[model samples]
Target: MKRILFTSTLAAALAAALFMTAHTVTAAPEGAPAPYRHVVLFKFKADAPKEKVAEVVKAFAGLKEKLPAVLSFEHGLNVSPEGINDGFTHVFTATFKDKASLENHYLKEPAHEEFVKLIKPVIEKVLVVDYVANFVDHGAH
Candidate 1:
């Protein structure tokens, strides 16, 4: 009788542990902040003049001013010593409240279309990535 009781208790404990693990893996932690991040990297043509590149940069920075959905915007030229940039010189990051805000900025905004038109001639390559930012506070523990 004792052996049967011990087996049952062990099985119950294992099941509970598995259930808790699955639940934690599938659910976001309470109070986690989700921000949509838009990342853009540009590689200008080798023969593009410095003045034209500067103009493109200025036009891109001006996008935040024209778009209400842009929560924050920043950009910089790559200075990494790793030399793995693949000829990409400039990177621009913009944060929006959510995916819908980003869509509005990228799709419906005329300013964005104009910027694209401006850069098309000078751009050699472009890469863009967008995702929901996951912020975790390690100090909360």
Candidate 2:
């Protein structure tokens, strides 16, 4: 009974720690607003060819150069050991100066439209989350 109690307590403590770390946010420098972040996760269809996926990634990476509103663009394959990814294999993050730039300019850009068309057929599922970044104080505790 004592061993079971200890194990449960340990699990709860570990969960709390994970929750805190996950929610912690980075602080921006004094008086500067944090940029808007557009995060996209993709699960490619099982039948999608590797070459086609590579092409899609190449096109997405190219968008940073094409759109002035895009402060940065990055993409990567999922490398997490966590099994909860729900088959999402690729992740992309695009940063913008503000929400207007992302929603109005970048999203409507001709190159972006073309890139979407390139990716749509090969993707099984897509999840997008956008936020204006803000700092949360959780200084190492």
Candidate 3:
């Protein structure tokens, strides 16, 4: 009886330790910076020239080098067959280390302002969304 009790206690202790380890591994570290994402969608004016749109895309892509706060930048034309895009043809995403980095780049950077001015003439509608990225466990169903 004592041996059985000892084995059960050992199993319980092991299970508790594993539970704690799993939780600790998944939890974000204290004071770790959450990733910030800046997303932009643009709908060009019907009369805008293709060359001008391409120039705007090129200018936006160059922001990564001009702005030290940019962690990553990507831009692409919409290709979805679903007609739900509401005339938006281009999308750009800029990732930063944190919200402060994003704010500095967008609000204070001269290069960004110039890029904005370059695109303003051809942009019919624009949508921008910014958010802090959240951790997700894709393995978990």
Q: Clash totals for all models, in order?
A: 0, 0, 0
For lDDT, the strongest prediction is 2
Best by TM-score: 2
| lDDT tens per residue, model 1, 47-127 | 999999999999999988889888899999999999999999999999888898888666578999889999999999999
> What tens digits encode model 3's per-residue C-alpha lDDT throughout 7-113?
99999999987666654433334587777899999999999999999999999999898888988999999999999999999999998988888886665888988
Q: Lowest-scoring 10 consecutive residues by lDDT in candidate 3?
A: 21-30
Q: What global local distance difference test value does model 3 have?
A: 0.86
Quote each prediction's TM-score.
0.75, 0.77, 0.75
Question: Each model's RMSD to truth, in Å?
Answer: 7.8, 4.8, 8.7
Q: Of models 2 and 3, which has the larger lDDT?
A: 2
When 2 and 3 are scored with TM-score, the better candidate is 2
**lDDT score, candidate 2, position 74:** 86
Q: What C-alpha lDDT values do all the predictions have?
A: 0.86, 0.90, 0.86
Off by over 4 Å in 3: 1-32
